[model samples]
Target: MVHFLPDILAFFFIAALIAQRLSVDLRLPDAAYQLITYILLITIGLKGGQAIANNASMALIGHSGLIITMGIVITLVALIIIQIFSKLNKADRVTLAAHYGSVSVGTFAVAVNYLEVSQIPYELTLNLFVALLELPAIILGLYLLSDKTHKLNVKTILAHKSLALIIIGMLIGALYGEISEPLVKNLKPMFGVMLALYLVHMGALAGAKISDIGSNKVFIVSFALIMPLIGASIALFCSWLIGLSHGGATLLAVLGASASYIAVPAVFEQAYPEANIAQALFASLAISFSVNVIWGIELYTQAALLISSL
Candidate 1:
């Protein structure tokens, strides 16, 4: 019974949801939420950059390509699932698939915390994979869309605030490895605190979307619940095939399971305005995000452990 309750950062998320359900009038300011986002993105970037600096290798290039392929495959599969099971229009299907295909940094942060709590060691370069996984889904979504009017803007995607911060942080970390040590040390302690704050904000937002599950209740809810399991299973198999460590496999599975609520929404709103962005966000943030935070993380970790031992 105790194990079923939310613990650690998840407690903040679940508490926020409960508060929202009770109409507690608790919410983080928009500016503060954005600030937290910036901090998290930069922190992940810096840490990953430092790791790459310490362990640069040609193998990373191969691994990166493989990860990108995984993102593409996930997006395609998600689209296929949506097309078959969902009555959403073509644009909405592609857009929603894009949301599932991309990685969620918030979820990644939680998984990282989970690994730390369990004393599991993962490749620091996993953040690099986080950055790598963001683009392919969006790009594929754009390409698949029937709308040919909006050209794929590589520069715009790269310059998106989230990716820019991460890339810049990585560059700084990679260039000034020793010099950035003090900054990383100072920020490391605040990582968990910031993530908890973010999740609190996220939970409130997700709670508000509870009524927005809309007409496709069965399909949306079913997909939201089941997609993470499918995605995590595929990722665990990939991790095993590549011989990733237990922590590495777990983190990868989390990334695979996560659905993007931030980056994908921002891009899709502008690029494909006709798509039902609100419903997509509701599905990804409210249902999928909640599922991952509450139960999926533990399941993925255990599954990773099993795969690593095989």
Candidate 2:
């Protein structure tokens, strides 16, 4: 009963989906959900800042760059893998690449929740950094997948409300940590409730979209199961190389394997509109949704045990 938060979240997500199936009124307004997401994201940034404040040292800084680099490389590799296994055009491939290249906040959130449920701790700054990895690879994916007529548009970047919020999160985190007092002061209680509310709303919304899942969801389903297995192994080995603890390595591996359905897709919709948003969205959502919801924790736990053994 105690070890059930992940499953509980999954349950709500599935329930929300069922509601969607039945055509129920479980729709969380886009603005409302987005607002919740913004609050939580800002909270995450503040948390990151606090982490930096407590453990101010070179050891922590080195890993942040490495983490972003890992995500960037993984994004490119995902594009290659999707192209090899699936039939997608250059434009479609570019869109898919960027989506997969970017990490999913929902997936990462689920993983962090799972970790805390299991009584494991990790650096908080990573919450903000996870979102930050795509600034480079997203642009690169555009260059790779966008047409010649589609020059890099600054409006594409600046126009995103969610993107703006996330970037604000990072800045607020940096500022809160460097100058102001703790970001987790009086705001923690409000943010805490906001996080749970946001998660519930997001869960309901995600489940409603489940019918969006179908027979064609296989390639994504398989990738969701397999990518983490591969990514976690890579992360484990990489973690050992960097001299991190086993737990940190496994979590980072989970991070590496994650696909960004939320942030990346939004970026692609603006930057590369012609790309098959449907396919990319399905694949990214499928892999990431399945992993964090059900399979990812099993993989993480199994991998962690195996790594511990070997």
Highest-lDDT candidate: 1
Candidate 2 wrong stretches, greater than 4 Å: 1-6, 54-61, 178-182, 185-196, 207-217, 305-310
Give the TM-scores of the predictions, in the order they appear: 0.96, 0.82
Best by TM-score: 1
- Pairs clashing within candidate 2: 17-207, 17-208, 103-260, 104-260
lDDT of 1 by residue, 117-142 (tens): 88899988788889888999988998
| Superposed Cα RMSD, model 2 | 3.3
Cα lDDT, model 2, residue 106: 64
Q: How does each model score on lDDT? A: 0.88, 0.62
Q: How many backbone clashes does candidate 1 have?
A: 0
* Candidate 2 positional error at 50, Å: 2.8
Candidate 1's error at 150, in angstroms? 2.3
Checking candidate 1 for backbone clashes, the offending pairs are none
